[model samples]
Target chain A: MKGSGGARRAPRSTPRPRGRPPGRSSRDGVIAGRDALLAAAERAIARDGPRVTLDAIAAEAGVTKPILYRGVGDRDALVFALAERLTRRMTDQVAEQVARTEDPEDMLRRLVRGYLELAAAQRNLYLFVTAGGVGDKRLQQSLLLADGAAQQFVDGIAAFRSARGADPAVATVWSYGLVGSLHYVTLWWLREPSLELETVTEHITSLLWTGLRLEEPVD
Target chain B: MKGSGGARRAPRSTPRPRGRPPGRSSRDGVIAGRDALLAAAERAIARDGPRVTLDAIAAEAGVTKPILYRGVGDRDALVFALAERLTRRMTDQVAEQVARTEDPEDMLRRLVRGYLELAAAQRNLYLFVTAGGVGDKRLQQSLLLADGAAQQFVDGIAAFRSARGADPAVATVWSYGLVGSLHYVTLWWLREPSLELETVTEHITSLLWTGLRLEEPVD
Candidate 1:
């Protein structure tokens, strides 16, 4: 019972790998094996689209289905792991870009552009992780991604609001809302890629920068 | 095939009721039957929560599983129908409130309040329709809901932006983004029901009204 129920049953079908691959510590070998399987899964999904099956993924990795199960637990767990990987890459890219900019407006623009570009580059993987799955697992994956992004956002938003003498309490709500908006917008863009990246970025930036109203006081 | 593949397979197991129930036209009878079944579904879901099975719904409706299937097609179709029903109600409520308000700010506030209140009132049904389901079907349901709302919002948003000399071209993106933000915020509010309705409404209103920045001029 190394993992979930699916993984628990896997060992009976195929015994666990006996020893670490030459010269690596057992822990490092486990991490390396998992990484290799995930990369193979990514390749299968990228080639075959989101509906790529675990059997296909195992074949892509040159492993048996039971080995794939042992490596990733189940479809839901695999999706979760892939989602985490994608979001981490996107987050790191956005953070690196944000770090390079000091002006608030520039930082915002960089963040938006970074996120959209990364998602666009990894379109199939994005859809695979985010769009296709069972309901509860999909929702869990979404919440996991949003919560991680929101956690990164809340502190910065709170500090910024406080510096502006505004209520910082809205940070949690604002962060979640912002992430949700970005997520939906990205999906829309991916579906209708005819919209230029610059144009889409500009529209979102304008909306966030100026709000919905173009010319009315908020009285 | 009367509907999707699931519905197509349903007819053999439970031959659809052949005659109109007493005195009603065939079409009217079909409508009435569907309405009754849906109403029964609402009750079952309301009582048992979102994961209530088709068998349970059929029992609640005082019908056999086959009859339930014939009436509603399948789980996905039932979920789709329920989402349409809920969104229609919410839309009508919001539209009526918007019609009553001459002030733009007031209209926006009413729209937000109306959506949140209706969703909060129908919490169980809302979860059943939106939160629990298969992945592709769930995404389709969400897009169906969002597209309906976006269609309603786009014309109004375009008109308002045009009046203010803003780019009406951004209307489609803006409408979709707005709906997505409101939807995610509602889900967050529902899961953490401790937050006051008034507070949630206020925060969202401020975000849409003023955007993310508390202070600073766009370059």
Candidate 2:
């Protein structure tokens, strides 16, 4: 209630011209430049945290703060824009990586692993998007991004299990369970940098592949 | 790094003296009164959000700010103490609920639902414990409360899972995955009030119960 829910999107790699009504003639340059600025902003955030400032982002983009301000309004706007783009890019990257795989299990595992890796490589960005605060608009958009990813991952789990006649319930639990666990892994990973990503992946995979309590087959 | 894990504890009904610690004798009259004040403060946070002021907390306790401050410290300490007590009550309550049942599946579902309900009831307390400013020592204690709850839940899941001869990798995945999903559920429930607790239980259970992707059976 305190902030905009879904109304405003933070500016991102996908750009919009400054406050011009839609379909304005001088939009393309504005869009491209905006995209560059957002990308630059994201890089800056990666180097710092959400505290990355307008001056820094502008510097990274090789543009003046005035130009950046005109493009995105303010610091919060810049973060919103950058986070949205980062989410989109990460989503697309995961999708593209899994495109060639036919097995849903393979796809899902790959997705989890890919996400974890990206989180490690871009720890700052991942932390910003997940735990960092912006306006409510950014929070809403980021929540949407998270929800969308969960849905896709859940679907993949269900379809894969059903394909092999595995208990559908088991599949449902397994997939979403993995989704739940990975979020924490990202969180913990940030705190304990030395924790091996490979080990994290291995341990999580072990849980999903096996389970918590060691029950054997009825046979 | 932030926020309490979900669930709200009901206000304790007992009365006690003000200004005296639990063991420090001689001032017994003030002990129950102070207890009453802290309990009332808990209720205030549970009803109001974390931003509810000391004046409000004290008023809710049927006393003045100085008396309340005498019991605790400053405002941050007041909020933290409330959060800690709330967490303590929640932990006890949850332990009681989960203890009655041996079935991991049932335990997890009920746990998720119960915690969500607690959080919804005490929005301010939940935010203070989970995502409030870090400088407050109370915030740190709250994190421990959350970590303890999460560890207990995860251990339950892990135990039930490993018993069935599920892959160790799978169990780990499920543990992290469920935690992540539940974290979001509390926030989502807040945003979408129409979402029934039963529905959330079913949906979350279904998502995790089904597992991750559309692929071959491991066996």
Candidate 3:
């Protein structure tokens, strides 16, 4: 139902025609096969938590271990691939929501709220991906997401301060700082739902605004 | 040699005094014993990385599993205890440094630099404490640190903005935001140490200053 590609395909119970196979191209076959495996993996993860084994995942996908291995390199590789897909979806959503506001404050507020909402919507998936692992792939994926978000902010901040001749190089640092804050804040806020989302957003926006606004040096 | 309390004491080689041990209270004995055990655990963690086991820790501490268990609850408890100690040391140092600066901007800048310096000084220990674990104790320790840091910032910011009648309630959120940013920045900065510390500090401080200083409200 979540557009898991192959999950909605005709059930395995459908009998294959004798002698002649349907004209599903090899490329389409590979893509559908991978999608089906991923969908099965997702179900397995949801049912068995993030630590589910490859054997279980393969069984859920209605395939053998070899097929699962062929489709996705390995467990770590599959998790990393899923992370890419999830992070992309979350960032794309945040980007779209952030673009809705012209005012920088509103833009940041929306960004924060959008991020929180996404976390709430996909709390389990978030936990599965963020469940600390032995590999550095997760951190690498995280940094990739942070870097992408920071670049967007850098571009926006640089343009906003262009007339004042502000050194745009600082944007890289500031954007990282902002993304880092957002990342940890999301984790913290997710655990404490009693903390009002709007209030947190306002505070974050205020912090960003105060920091970004031009002012005399405070020595 | 590290101060590991009773663990560092002469190995049961000296003859016991005939009379009751002169003025060595039971409470003092317990305290010293714990310190010694903790010291041993620290050495083990330093040598074996964060994933070092309780058995290894006990061996390093010169005690058996029972003694280590009695001295520290378990592995998780031991880690939690160590986190408490480390977090306390780090925050106490930060507090002392922050107190030296009366200017708010200078105070915040000092706070940021102090935290990074602590991370750099004890990178291994930092990893030991922050090594991703199962239970939420790590998060709890993190929250404890953030709450402490936030309280300090809230008090300072409230006092600084008292004349402007700024609502101090927002300080809680701002403080957490600042702490989260610092936490993530430290992690990022650690991995990419090629970047100068002063530059990162300057960028972070600038962002904080721009956000904290009064300016026209963004509509």
| DockQ order of candidates, top first | 1, 3, 2
The residue-by-residue lDDT of candidate 2 on A154-217, one tens digit each, is: 5655554554554434333334344546766566555555546666766655444433333432
Worst 10 residues of 1 chain B by lDDT: B1-10
Write candidate 3's Cα lDDT for A11-96 as tens digits.
Answer: 57658565534665566546437778877887887777556778988889876787788988776678766666677787799889
Q: In candidate 2, how many Å is residue B105 off?
A: 1.8
Which ranges of candidate 1 are over 4 A from the true structure? A1-32, A64-66, A132-139, A164-168, A217-219, B1-32, B62-74, B132-139, B164-168, B217-219
Q: Which structure among the candidates has the greatest lDDT?
A: 1
Q: Model 3 segments beyond 4 Å from truth?
A: A1-28, A31-79, A134-141, A163-169, A212-219, B1-32, B135-139, B163-169, B212-219
Interface RMSD of each: 4.4, 5.8, 5.7
Whichever of 1 and 2 has more lDDT, that candidate is 1
**Best-matching candidate per TM-score:** 1
For model 1, residues B13-63, the per-residue Cα lDDT tens digits are 556776536654456445438889999999999998777889989988877
- The 10 consecutive residues of candidate 2 chain A with the worst lDDT sum are A133-142
For all predicted structures, in order, the TM-scores are: 0.77, 0.66, 0.75
Model 2 residue runs over 4 Å out of place are: A1-32, A53-69, A74-76, A134-142, A159-180, A206-219, B1-86, B133-146, B157-176, B213-219
